[model samples]
Target: MNINKLIRIFFLLIISSIEIGQSLVPVERHGHSAVLVDKKLYFFGGESVFGKLKNSIHLDQILYIDLSKPFNTANPPFEEVINAPMPFGSSYATAFLSPQKKNIIYLFGGIMWDVNANVDKFKSILYSYNVETNEWIPPATTGIAPEKRREINGVINNETGKFYAFSGLDTNAQNVVTTFNDMNILDINSLTWSKGSITNAPLPRVDYTATLLSNGIIVFIGGRETNNLVSVDINQLPLYDTKVDRWSTMTARGVTLENRNSHSAILTSDEKIIVFGGNKDDIATPVLNPLAVLNTKVVPYEWSVPTPAPPLPLTTNLHSATLVENYMFINFGQVHPKNDSLLQKPFFYILDVRNFTWVEKFEPEQLSQSPNGTTTVNTSSTNSPGLGVTTPDNGKQIGIIIGAVGISVGVIAVAGLLGYKYYKKQKYTRAIPTAGSPTI
Candidate 1:
């Protein structure tokens, strides 16, 4: 083999931007949110950094990707922009779209950092976006927003469009500790938010999973407290029914489906809830494993041991996931890399939940893809007043600085060379509307 040819081959070798099984890039931040609307999936702000604590690097821009369209690295579907930016930059904000044709998505208060790195208090701002006009409007009714929530679960009762939120962990007095148990619900049609009846509610947890059952029941899964302890036995998760406004005291016994947080609850089309890849043995350094979820409808006290289910391609936490028609499209998230200081690589995988198969192979050349690289910068900016940007002192690119720079350069260069010719044709040439005349 010629050495020169080898060098050229290396340069041409397109290490894929597509992540098949393991993450191609590390998704550093957690608590970011995603939704599917207009056959397109949209994602909003969340914190991303190389620290145990959440940071103030809030992203104000929205990311929308088409689900119906096939995505390829060689030819990717371009992301479309919607109406206007939200009022402020935020992460872990609670949002759910009204299920009507309007497909209006509502966002309630979570938390945002002012231009300063100091994480701002939970916001009371409530706004909704319309899929049709790409417009935002405040609902007619106004009242107190949920006390600034952080990890509270976001579940829309499929029965009603109302969103059900539960406990989440947040920083208390100092950045040193964890925050806990608060529950709230919002009526989408009226745009009114009110506290849910709290009785035997589970202790405050940050990363719990909630599954709205078909039998008009809301099942709350494993979520731990601020102290990182399970208030209930690891073997059982506290259950609640929003419809009856009562608790299912039956500790789902026997099965080791430990009520764990940061796990995924994907309700399958066949009406079975599939819980996958969450830390169980420990929470501090979560050990992610796949567990099967049984119907266990209404029989609140019975706990069935989860048959060791098929394994996911990778261990992921803080990654974004959504259920498409036949598959679950999980986006990039962080893995505890051996080297903590350095960023983890981000990657995505498509799970065929129906067949219980995690795709290890795909038409790599044809799969939809993007380069989602992560870097941290202090986004503490005072450009505006109270609503300021966090300008990172250490300069960084959160994702891509995508804009018109490339197009502008190309257009300007071409225009300069063709300027004289165009001018000459206009000034010296006679105007004629001939049948075959060139348009330009």
Candidate 2:
């Protein structure tokens, strides 16, 4: 080959390497919902192109995938728990199991109308599903019934059995849905409601955040009104206190977090709300914010340092980020320069919160196998298709029940390899770099 051609080929090779290293993978569909039950993660209904909500998990009317089994894996075509239907067969409702009340998972108001402004018509109703009884109880009308709301954010303070519902859009007389500032606290035990006209509330916004800190205070942030579904910054907005049901203008310590919506927040083992990316307002889509992390009490909100970790590999995407135990799992989301309307199908990435690092891409099969024993039959079977049907689990499916924990072992392994490579590369590169001697 000609000398010039050889040099050109070498440069091309380097470029190809860079591109390959940066390639993003295709995950699952958009518009899906997820909840963490008994350490395992269960994803439910999502909107499809046909515009019909899908219950792909259920064989008949029930959701098909419980995903709490030990043998579950992402290898492909794995068995999902085809048992049990969601309380009302609803989607887009903020869903989560109460940490203190294992028997129930609380799903509060949600709808699919406005991406930013409130669409006047939305269901104010919220319900809870009892995993043990397989029953759905609507919020009591006189007791804890939420003020009629849709698309509002809900957070449960398990310690106090209080579910705090805040900042959503309401319909005007002409039937126009606009942003609202109403804050209603619902008691899970008493099924009672407390409507507090909170003072100095964050401006009327939707898609904003209200997270329950380990200290038992509520941190409110990122949403939109006439604007878009993005908070200017987690730092810009003040965090709220649920204990007293009050608002404060203070911030957290350390690195200020990026404003995000459609993103998930998890309470880390060490007590921090590790935030991942969501859609950015400047753009019409979701993107990963590598610089997202929050730690501290809420009253006088302070900023904390974000882990100098890898960015969400792509932009203009939103995924269901679920925290199982200490591990943070981000499920199938989209990427866009392509626009939010076009997101990749669902897949997942995990972060080992204890170690403060992001995990490499792996399917469900890569996780640890769950412990095997007699299936707990205390669970009543209803529309749930396939429960208590334990054949010989492949060990992979059962691992999911063990939760994001299996990934912890993998994190250790990956860390060892990375450390070894870094040490060797630094030593070898250092030994080779003597510019004065190499000049010959």
Candidate 3:
């Protein structure tokens, strides 16, 4: 090919290569927790779609997103947990890694869907799944525990070996729901529950964040305070002093966030909490500065909203987020990109927390359904389809896509080089001197 033609082909190849390498996969979901264990991200149960639709279902599969995978690949990065005890898929449940036990994840109460009753049910069961042993065990506890609740969050105080739970929604036998503005603690060692002594508590709230700071202080952030379900001021930075057993609102300086609930936040290595992707005015709005950072290491706690913040992969709420290494992996939230409608697709995105830039978006593979209209993973048993009845190999399709993209780019690169070489040789031959020509 001529030099001009070669140049044109080279530019096209470069563009295609870049585009392929920059795509992201976001898992469509909400009300799920993305737990980080070393390099792997473990995503537990969550609500896939919300509304009165009888077909709307809760996601029960325990999915693990391998963050180690190259970000350029546009494929389902999620894998269902295999040979593990799966919970009866739930949403709004709190999950935390056991500080004392290696690879143990403790899951607390959440809301589950009961098809028979046609209502969301609150659960009080606490189960522990050991990632190392691939076993699930129910720990027996003593003392008075909180009633079946949902929309709460907690943190484990490694020093005391205790798990502290904050306010959540309480429902009665008649299905009457009320938000409880109380605190509860579970002893990790004894698996015992007890009431916590907290004064001046915030109003009954749900879907808030409980971040354990470096100093062992659990900072409670935005939620739907009161049964009215309105967003409270971001300035009300409530701090739970586990040591003093007292709750006090801290003075926050700098840019305050818009009131929101069902959002997700992560405690950074610098002792700052980065909050993102929540509802404003009860619905997810497409807006800049959906992200905020709280500098908990400093006195009077300063809140800084990053100027020119990166846009979220989507405007969403009721999502779960956790920090792993330098990147924050946020998966599945309720997307409300339009005013007339909302969707509960399991999509997720990753953010480079260092610069607050979005790294990529990922989408999980479309789950296959069994004949009974239940989702099945890896051809598991036909019994009530819980989070993955069977361990299905989900990464094969993604690997093929990645390999194809890589090969396409490679072939294009080689062709361009060859074209250039051929053009250079043709030009040299045309300029060569004949046998009798002067070698000037």
Which predicted model would earn the best lDDT? Answer: 3
lDDT string for model 3 (100-170, tens) is 77478888877655544545653456878888776766677799877777888878776677888887886
The TM-score ranking, best first, is 3, 1, 2
Question: Please, what are the lDDT tens digits per residue for candidate 1 over residues 1-440?
Answer: 65445434433332222223321222345556666663566766666665322234664546666544345322333353534554456676656555544366776655655524454643455667776666766556655465555755576764465777776655555665546455667776566777766677766666666666655556666655756555335345555677776665445644555445566666654455566555543644545344455555435434443432455455666556666555566654555443454334434566665566666432212222234332221110000001111112122222222233444455455555455565667676566566888877
Considering lDDT, which of the candidate structures 1 and 3 is the better prediction for this target? 3
**Estimated TM-score per prediction?**
0.65, 0.63, 0.70
Cα lDDT over the full model 3 = 0.67
Question: Ten residues in a row with the worst lDDT in model 1?
Answer: 379-388
Q: What are the lDDT figures for the candidates, one per model?
A: 0.53, 0.52, 0.67
